[model samples]
Target: MNKDIIYKDLDSLLNTLNLIQEEQTVIKRKLSGLLDHVVPNHFIDWAEEIHQQILNREVALQLLRKDIIALKKTIVQKKSIIYFVNNQYVKLIIKYKEQIAYLENEFKLWAKVTAEKFDTIVA
Candidate 1:
């Protein structure tokens, strides 16, 4: 019935489904052997058209793989930035809460350091 509890549950569920790690591994493996699976595009001087097509595809896949690798690097850097931001926010929130609690306590010893008690002199 509490919204905060619901939000926490949803956040946990979303965290379980994070695809960053899995996708990163898959992408690295694919990029590592991107050209390994394809048949060679060497010229045999027999079928020019078919060889040309194969070469064209090889070039396209190579180019696309490079682009994808670059994009992945960018995504990972951005993700790290986001993770850093989230960590800082969490730390700030905890510190702020602690400070508020300290201020709300029954005794404030810190006020003694920054303040002085003055009394009027009876002449």
Candidate 2:
């Protein structure tokens, strides 16, 4: 791998990581809003359905977090492989990082929407 290419890829990876972090921040904020609206009175007969939705969201969120961790690991590994030199692998790492961020954001949106629907049903 060319030294110049390695540096360029590293820079691109860093930018992608920053974008992922920004996305994560937005998701956290949305989730927080959903949490704020949770109420016990909303459960009733629909409790079972609401519970299922919550459970599903929990599982999805866990998976998204796991993917984020894996992306971080891949980034670290790619950096090591580059060893301060340019490499072609950086593009693949960036793609995965973007994908992880997208999945995380998608899950967060789903969770938020589910919570809102539950809230409406209970209200």
Candidate 3:
């Protein structure tokens, strides 16, 4: 892929990840509020569904955390600071960036899966 396209995709992905985090936060808060107020027995099933949604959100957050770690590792490796390090260190840094990018893409796939799960749960 073109470097420019890669960078643009990265930027858009980061923004989407940020929005997902925010939505997860809001869902957690709302779930807590719902739990505080006791509803009729008929609503228990809906509450359980919400609980599952919360769990899915938690899973998404975990995926996001992994992505963040990978992103940080990539950023560190791509920097010029490795020039001062030994040759092996420089090679390791380059390797790290490549590996992290692969892992980041995996996490992104998980994010998409979790998103679909969320939509199904919500629907």
Candidate 4:
């Protein structure tokens, strides 16, 4: 793949991540508000832990976004070079992609479980 294309993709990914982070902030606020009214219980504690995990994931994603930005700059400077399979930047990109995928899936599952639990309690 062309370096220019890769840079563009990285920039796009960063934009998407920024949007996701904003959404996550909204979600966290909602969860916090919901937790505030819920009676103390083991399930509530579990939900709080999940919220903490979400915060940790946000921090991790922020760091990853910084790394991606740095990598994009490096890609621009190394325009003449071709990335081989052994390239560190390529490996890092793959790792970030995998992490994003894993986190997204986990978030979806957590949302489903939280909704189900809240439904049972509220109903």
Which candidate number has the best lDDT? 4
Kindly list the per-residue Cα lDDT of model 3 for residues 1-123, writing each as its tens digit: 233443454455555555655665665565456556746564456667656865765576566556645654564466454432446544543554454455456545755664564455445
lDDT of 4 by residue, 1-123 (tens): 776667777877787677668867766776677777776787588777878878887888888888888877777666465552337877888887877777677767866776676667656
Could you tell me every candidate's TM-score relative to the true structure?
A: 0.28, 0.37, 0.44, 0.75
Global lDDT of each candidate: 0.36, 0.53, 0.55, 0.74
Off by over 4 Å in 1: 1-46, 80-123
What is the C-alpha lDDT profile of model 2 across 30-51, one tens digit per residue?
4455456654544433445544
In candidate 2, list every pair of residues with a backbone clash. Answer: 5-86, 6-85, 6-86, 6-87
Model 4 residue 80 lDDT?
65
lDDT per residue (tens digit) for residues 23-65 in model 1: 3334334323433443344312212443353345345434433
Model 1: lDDT of residue 51: 35
lDDT of 3 at 40: 59
State model 2's lDDT.
0.53
- Stretches > 4 Å off in candidate 2: 1-43, 80-123
RMSD per candidate (Å) reads 30.4, 7.1, 7.8, 2.7
Best by TM-score: 4
**Order of candidate numbers by TM-score, starting with the best:** 4, 3, 2, 1
